[model samples]
Every structure is written in structure tokens, then in C-alpha cells.
Target: MRVWAKSGVAFNGVIAVVVGLGCALFALMAGLAWPAIVATSVALAGIAWLMTIRQDIRRHFVVKHPFPDEWHEILNRSVSFYRKLDEPAKRRFERDVQIFLGEQRIYGVEGQEVPIETKLLVAASAATLSHGRPDWEWGRTRDIVVYPKAFNDEYDVADGAKIAGMVQEHGPILFSDRDLKYGYQRSADGYNVGLHELAHVVDLEDGRADGIPGDLNWMAAMPWTDRIHKDLTNKHGRHLKRLLGNYAYTNEAEFFAVSVEAFFERPKKLEQRDPELYRLLSHYFNVDPRTGRVIEPVD
Candidate 1:
């Protein structure tokens, strides 16, 4: 299996090179001391190189250290998505999990202890989503906060609280521990808090949660927008409600998240019931959830 590099390594490398050159040029134009210019360039380059290689260093250790047997047991027992992976893909998934856990922090709210099991589940959700797109990475700086129970919009846990999970645009992801466990327990229920919220993150990649992910070609974008409008307006309301649930109709972002849940949890049904939607999602995600096989789009 190819070792997974840390996310944004390439982007950071480019920034490092540009900054070093820019600083050196400015220093020379200002007739600053040669020694100081060289020092600035070297320091900037060194920092960038270190940032770029951090993931490689972590990947090397991940390769040497066998994935924990206990973690494997948990995935096998809990993640239906993991069970569908082939051996090579499984190894890749394991490596991705380790890298994610190494980089991101997961803490319990209200002093609730987060077990290894829950941590593994969080990583598994990420690995499952990015399995086909090996280059995709969760932001390194984000934290996963676990609430003891569902919380209200005000971010408080109460008897009438309704939110099971939420992803802030520039803040940490909050998940109800109760909903998180239940989502996995009923894996085929078409509702996974982890996948649902992460889907929002995907939508927000372009700095907006408008149900459109980044890098979508205009060819696909037009159709996607049309479909979202059609579904939102109830042109296919009865069928959509049966496949995805009423929450999907709440908004385009919610529809996309709900569709992601159905795509993985009930892939064949989604394909059979809504072939075009399945095809569009498969094109975007680059994998067939039903077969766990990567789909190379034709140009």
C-alpha cells in the first residue's frame, strides 16, 4: 500500500518556496546584508521542508508498527464500510486512520471520557469517506468534540435538544456521543452523524456550505445544481422521502449530507432507486460504495 502523506503537504511546500524567494528578493532590493538575506531564506525553506515531511515521518512509523489488533476488531465489528474493503484497500484505510488520529484531537465534552473505540470510529468515518480519493485529507487543525448527548442550537444539552451533530465552518466538530454510537449500531439506517457532518465539511471546502464541493467541472456542476433544485422543490418528493428522509429537503447542504449517508449505507438501493443521483455522487466521490472500487472518470 502507498503510504498516505499528510494533507496539504504539497500546498505548504509551494508556499514555503514562494515565501523564501519573495523574502530574499525584498532583502536584496533593500540592499540588506547578504548574511541576513541568506539566513532568512534558509530558515523559511527549512521550516517548510519540515512541514512537508512531517506526514512522511509519521507514515514511516505507521508502516513499521502493525495496526493494533484491537482497532481492527473494533472496525470489523462496527464499521460495515470497512468490511467491504479489499486487503490492499484495508491496509490503506488503516494507515489513513492512524495518520488522522495522530494529527487531530478528539476530546469529550463535560469531562466525558472518550474511549479508544469512539476514537477509532471517528477515524473510520474519515477513512471511509476518503478511501477513493487518497489525496483528500481532513484539516489537521480541527478538533472532534464529543457531547454526552444531543445538544440544542444554543450548544446546550437539554431534554428537548434535537441536534445530533454539527460542524462549524471554522471551528471544531461537535457530535452527540449517543447519536454517534447509535448511528453505527444501525449502520443501514441511512443516518450517520459522522458522515453527515463531514459531508458539510466537504461542501465548505470552497468556503461555503452551498451543497457544491470544490473542483467540480461545469459540465457536472450544471446537472448537480439542477438536481438539487429539483429535489428541493419536491419534483421527486415521494421517492426522495423514501430514500433519504424529510431532513434532506431542509436545504441543499442537508440534502447532500443525507445523500452521502444513503450512498454508503444503502448504496445499491440508492443506485436502483435514483441511478442518476448515484452516478453523480459516484463521479464526485470516485468510488462505488456498493463495490468499494474506484471509478476512473472518462475525460
Candidate 2:
């Protein structure tokens, strides 16, 4: 129940040190700066102390799932993957969702409702990515900011340049509320923005996002790299496009994310079209997910 990820704690430590030194340097350049330097050092010391106690505070609040029946009903309706699970697995998923909700915050944009449904949907995306790795945590993520429509880094409402979702190394993950709901509501389009972005978070776990996620060993990494290289740089060019769709060809990270969406949503289709890549993802995720056995109740 650590509040900060290992990397995040280290990053914060580095920031504190850098800020202290920079303040000291600026004070030294001025004549009467001892008081300023003392104040800066004290502030940074407070920051360091807060960082040290963050984990303790987080541990104090961690608890088992306490969601009511209404929440489970929402899951049964919107989250097909959860609906397919047996009672035990469903409980496990619910536990994971509760854990995630406790650990991270989800903020809505422009007075949008951050209801239990929204929180559960976000949790389902996280649970699906880390179901194989129970120890996996989103400690690096501080919050998930959801905009009503699409937005850019500057929060501009771009038309054609609209972004569906994005995961950042040093900032909150961003999502469009409209697109996020669509991703789950549509279910099987192989276009889940939430899952796609969460997959990037998985890739970032090993401190990098260069096509290889943290789940793979060097042995698996090597072959995955080779396959990606062959596909991305192939002379036939459009063959990879045909196999994985156009967005995947944008880059290696996108390829992995797009493949993850397809892996979960259209596993059989992916296996039929590109069995090798499908097997790679299947091994990485540790589930076939080819049955497509979700029970989406007709409204």
C-alpha cells in the first residue's frame, strides 16, 4: 500500500535536492540571502518529510471492497469481462476495483458526473491490464482527468486533432468522457481508449515504453522486438497495416496498445489474422480471451 511508486519517490527526492541546491545557488549570488536559503531548505525538508510519511497514510486507508449492489449491477451491464467471471473471480475483480478507487482519483471535466459507474469502468480497465500481476499498482498515477469531449495537452477542444486518451510519464492520464464511455459501451470494436491507454501504463512499469512491457523477460522481449521490427520496417509496408490496423503502424508503443485492445476485444479475429502476434500477446497477458463470452444484457 505504498503511496508512491519506487520511481516516483526517487523522482520526488531528486526534485527536492535539485530545488534546494538551486535555491542555495541563487541566494549565494545575492548579498543578503542567508534567510532566503534557510527558508528554502526548511520548505524542502517539509516536502521530504511528507514524502516519507505518504506510504503510512496510504496504508491507514487501504481496505477491502465496500461497494453496494448497485455498483455490481453497473458492472454486470457495462463491464462484460467482469460479467463473464465466476462469482469468485467477480469478487476478485470487485476487490481490485475497490483497491484502485482507493488508490487513485478520477476527476471529471466541466461539471461532468464522476459517478460510481465511471469509477468502476476505469477500474475495470486497470484490472484487465494487471489481472495477471496482482502486485501491479498504479502508484505513479496521481489522477485520471476526464474531459467531456476530446482535449489536447493544453486542454484546448480540438476538432480534428482531438485526443481520445493518453498516458504520460510525469503527469495524469487523460481521457475523453465521451470516448471512454464509447470504448466500453461499444465493447468489441477493438477501439477501447481506456484499455489502450492503460496498456501504455503497463509498458511504463519497467521505466520505459519502447514496445516491451514489464511483464516480459529478455527472452520474450527479444522475439517481440524482432517481430515488431519485421512488421514496422517490412518492404511490403501495408501488410502490417492490414494485419494490425493503421494506428498500430504509427509506432511501436501504439502497436502494443492497439494489439492489446484487439487482444482483449477481438482475440479470435487477431488469432485468425496474425496468430504469431496473437500468441505473443496471449502469452504476455496469460489469457486466451478468445471465447468472447461476455453477457451484455439487451436494453
Candidate models: Cα lDDT each: 0.83, 0.73
Model 2 residue pairs with clashes: none
Q: Which stretches of candidate 1 lie over 4 Å from their true place?
A: 1-48, 215-219, 297-299
Best candidate, lDDT: 1
- In model 2, what is the error at residue 296, expressed in angstroms? 27
* Per-residue alpha-carbon lDDT of candidate 1 for residues 213-278, written as tens digits (9 for 90 to 100): 655666768888988888788886487678898888889899899999999999888887778788
Model 1 poorest 10 in a row by lDDT: 1-10
lDDT (tens digit, per residue) of candidate 2 on 118-153 = 677888898776665554667745578887778876
Clash number by candidate, in order: 0, 0
